[model samples]
Target: MKIGDPLNRSTDHGPQNHKAHLDKLLEFCQMGIKEGATLVYGGKQVQRPGFFFEPTVFTDVQDHMYIAKEESFGPIMIVSKFKTGEVDDVLRRANATEYGLASGVFTRDISKALYVSERLNAGTVFINTYNKTDVATPFGGFKQSGFGKDLGQEALNEYLKTKAVTIEY
Candidate 1:
């Protein structure tokens, strides 16, 4: 297995709340996995002896699939290809989802990287890293993914309300 192989399932698995439609999630993953995407890691319903999944990856995934549109909580990744010099294509695909949490752009071209970082429609855009977090940075989801910021100093502001009191002196 590689350093980030999907087959290396986490042992801390358990029943998750079906707040986001489990059937839809499964369907999305299946559609992507079936469309030439290799299931390298996770696609199991039950852990059996342990709460672990196969940790899967789907390479060569096709666009317009549900997996590409939705977010998977497990260790499932879909690697898709786009035309060279077609940054717009990637941008469109990346922004097609209702969820806008975090995104990353990896490239040597500084201009292209900056452009993508500015236009990804995500709350946090990392130029060359995914899941880079900081206590001083604001974090939140957009659209159906939910709202309200968390982390950093700004987190406290979200839970606060301001009021102006009038007094006659």
Candidate 2:
């Protein structure tokens, strides 16, 4: 993606939220290389004035790799191949994580997508899409990603303090 001016109306993407995040993205890119993942595309900074990192894609990523198991919050996509009918194994590997903020499943079969998304530990699951959310839908992570939400009714509940009460005769 193009790291252009954020204020520009036509800008597709912008710089990272922070320099530390950009540094971590660069570090993860290098870590992927050190861990034997093939750098398919874009692993360097944009060489611009801002903290902009290139969208990186790595192939041959293993489940045991640091980049695979760690919680990376940048534009990095790791590819691990599995057989067509091995959805169970894929789910196991996908759920084998301490942080579960979000996960994605791109499949033509609606039933399979529903089945897989339900089993994923992530709070947000995208079927045939990514990073797409609505204000009406609850958004939050299940594990170490976070405990609260930022949008919808779930976010409103964060401010609530309620307890159960009962009276019997």
Candidate 3:
């Protein structure tokens, strides 16, 4: 789903499912923190009842690090600042990972956005937005992230078999 709304960021102790999911997410987040990514925010789990966790952010993340390279699949975000004119740097960092399911480009320059969009080795690219989704769009990852597309018309092709029809004319 496209995550346009403001996320809890921290573990939501108010909800049971939120706590459970946040707990698993915490493990992944801390792993990244330990690996050297800066913990910009939300590093600790709430001591009170429920699965309340702090909303965490990581900065100064290196591209080679496990946290920066892997998909956290959580509320955590690792941000790396880049120069104003150097879009290529960000593109390289974003495309450096093994997983290439989707990516986002935020810029005012249309040409730069298009250039990065075209150069990025991902199946899906969104300009100026992150985690945007559509019912008609296909979603999946490349390399070790796994194979096959989910949702949309591409989903129908997953179980389909191609047959060659031959006739003597």
- Identify the candidate with maximal lDDT: 2
Please state the error at residue 124 of candidate 2 in Å.
Answer: 1.0
Error of 1 at 59 (Å): 2.2
RMSD per candidate (Å) reads 5.1, 2.5, 5.6
- Reference-based lDDT, residue 155, model 3: 86
- Candidate 3 residue-wise lDDT, 50-123, digit = tens: 55556567888877777777775555656776676777787877877877766667778888789888998777
Comparing 1 with 2 on TM-score, the higher-scoring candidate is: 2
Name the runs in model 1 displaced over 4 angstroms. Answer: 1-27, 45-55, 165-169
lDDT of 1 by residue, 1-169 (tens): 2223224554233443452544444665677766656776666644344333444567666666767777776546566665557889888878878878766677777888898888888877777666657788989877766677899887898878999999999
Q: Candidate 3 versus the native: TM-score?
A: 0.67
Q: lDDT of candidate 2?
A: 0.85
Candidate 2's TM-score reads 0.84
**Reference-based lDDT, each prediction:** 0.67, 0.85, 0.71
Off by over 4 Å in 2: 5-12, 163-169
For lDDT, candidate 1 versus 3, the one ahead is 3
Q: Pick the candidate with the highest TM-score.
A: 2
